[model samples]
Target: MTASRARLAGSTALVTGGSDGVGLEIVRMLADAGADVIMPVRNRAKGEAAIERIRETVRDARIVLHDLDLARLDSVDALTAGLREEAAIDICVLNAGVVLLGDRRRHLTADGFELHFQTNFLGHAALIRGILPLLERSRARVVVQTSIAAARARIDWNDLNGARRYSPYRAYAASKLALSLFGLELARRSGRITVNLSHPGVVPGTAIAAPVRALLPQDLVNWAVHRVGNAPATAAQTAFDAATSEADAPVMFAPSGPFGLWGAPVPRAPFRRFLDADAAARVWREVDRLLS
Candidate 1:
């Protein structure tokens, strides 16, 4: 609601993980703006329920739900193919991700890449590639949801899978870093399509917080989360801006409050590494190889 809710009227949008959290907020806002939203949910029932909730407010909302498992590349392909059969897409939001704080052990996807790496980074890479033609047809804006944690992360180029060293936070940070690279590189490569990255900042209500909360006392956890985390709608502003704004702004959008934690959306420089075109290109090449 911070931005113009009617900005995307008469458009088509595809959002990953639209079932909950900031993604759900984005879906709702887009639907309110009169966009035909295509949501790829892992759980069809949960997706239908979210659509029902949105319908309560936007009675004429247009939402199409498709089954997608980002952990599996085949699922990504299925979604891309389905999208191609429809009209050109105006937006694609890669927002689904996970933080394996509940399990410190390194887990791999069916394709053998680290779980977070594959789900957060590689899956998105493959998806954008498969849907490149549709994006080209519409000159779509691609918004990748990254994290502020990515600013502190270093892509362990030598041990991309965390085989040598791994921690819950480290793995998640690396995946975000990779995603940032992909967004920047994609923008550089394709002039017809607009690509941007956004960080929702600290949205404590998000499911990624579930694993960490399990380790803390209920009362203390609730108090701490309330103090540090912005509401999902507030955090979602940066993402919404990146997706719908027409301003010729920086490609990275983040929260505008203290330490980029909470406020309205604003464009900011990403990490220093993200500025390096060479590094971005390198990551893109690596991602392309993995997806191949």
Candidate 2:
């Protein structure tokens, strides 16, 4: 494996969902690269376990864990409130997300929006806004985790909640698409802080997809995902590279192999729909309204 090219000697990073999967890999990479990393996890036990696992490889890795459940707005608020007084984050990776393909039936978060939408898009939006002051203070750049699905996804603005028509794939794709738009819009609005988006391609072994995989045919799941996706560690490189690179705008990064399924990190734009400035503004307004 090629070593990561980015160096972060005096930087501090905040990574969401760093307990497992690609997020975990990013944490390990960031810590290995000499950055002080802060991770917000859903529970203490999992967080501690993750820390232990990382330390096994990085003996002196600087990692701090806090409680954060992105599915709940209150949790997102609580975490940011603490950060405001603690430290200025130099790099923020919004990587926590859920993909529920177990049942196509729609589900709602505590805030009453579609579960995937809230956790993947709305919550991250709130966290970013809440930490905007610190980010600006540090000239921090935001790294948003999107997906290849977003390249083909569309936002049903009229039905943001997926209440009218729902499908797991559609809901997940739409949430990621919304995230891509948020990153693009943030870059357009801010001159001090850079905002970039990355698609990790297909990571078949992610714990995020485990729930859905449980209900599906095991062989079929393995076949379909393994056929096109890389392991979480491999998939994470694109986001890691983008997060630590010198890109100063809203560039989207993805792998550079057959169908963007695997390889080194490369700049790849999403569909024009994701770059719609008006749509991005509309989504930002809607997110603020929802949070309010």
Candidate 3:
């Protein structure tokens, strides 16, 4: 094993969305590094399948699966409650998300929030809050998987739920922006644990890109994605780096390739908009109020 992987031999990691795509790749890397991996998935079968796949390479891989639906606060709470009893959690990768590309209709979760906003941002905020104590105690590295879309998106404070106006891509971008802001703010507020943001670049075959299949010819899009986009394993490097690095402060990692599309992971500055302290604090307060 590489030195970095060897360092993680006795650590524990919690990863979300580990069933497939970039998430599955991240989980495999963690398991291969000898960390005890805990994956909270929305689908049990998929989670089991992911574990089986991981063990194919890391024959003695230690992995546990739990149920979690980011759209439901109750589910998030349940997972958090169980995790709190654990002795140590060295890493937490907030990576699960939903992206609706061509769909025009706005959907709400059972919690009555916009699907993207809830799944991508609010639920993660709640999970972070719920596990704050454990994180603090372990001094864990919390890696938040953000997106390139966040660079151009602006959060509509008035229409956070998309009740006033909505578009699939807009909603997705806004949710990512909110998540970016919250992650930045969390980094500032919590000195006990490290918080890092990772932009995995455009990974084409992943579920997040599935929506775009409806907008264009699937074959053409697939061809383009394969031609220009990074594969799931390649895209997962940014988050993997963030989770394992010993950076003391919050660092944003992204692809070093052109336009931040596909390349090796490197430390990059966050989007100019994400640097707004007031906006980050505002988002933090709003999430707290909503969760309360």
Best model number under TM-score: 3
RMSD of 3: 1.6
Tens digits of lDDT, candidate 3, 222-258: 6867787788888888988999888897888898989
Superposed by TM-score, candidate 1 places the C-alpha of residue 93 at a distance from the truth, in angstroms, of 0.9
lDDT of 1 by residue, 1-292 (tens): 2235776778999989889888888888888887899999999999999989888888888999998999998898888888779887998899999887778899988877899998888888888999898898898899999887788888888998889998878899889888988888888888788888888887776767777678889997888677776788777777778888675434788878888887677888776867878888999889867776
Query: What are the TM-scores, per candidate, against the unseen true structure?
Result: 0.93, 0.92, 0.95
Question: What are the lDDT scores of the predictions, listed in order?
Answer: 0.84, 0.84, 0.89
Comparing candidate 1 with candidate 3, which one achieves the higher TM-score?
3
Stronger candidate by lDDT (2 vs 3): 3
Q: Which regions of candidate 1 fall more than 4 Å away from where they truly are?
A: 1-4, 215-217
For each of the candidates, the C-alpha root-mean-square deviation to the true structure, in angstroms, is: 2.1, 2.6, 1.6
Candidate 1 RMSD computed on C-alpha atoms after optimal superposition onto the true structure: 2.1
Candidate order by TM-score, decreasing, is 3, 1, 2
Residue-level lDDT tens digits of model 2 in 124-239: 99999988989988988789998877878989989988878899889998998898898788878887788878778767677546775677898989786767577777777877
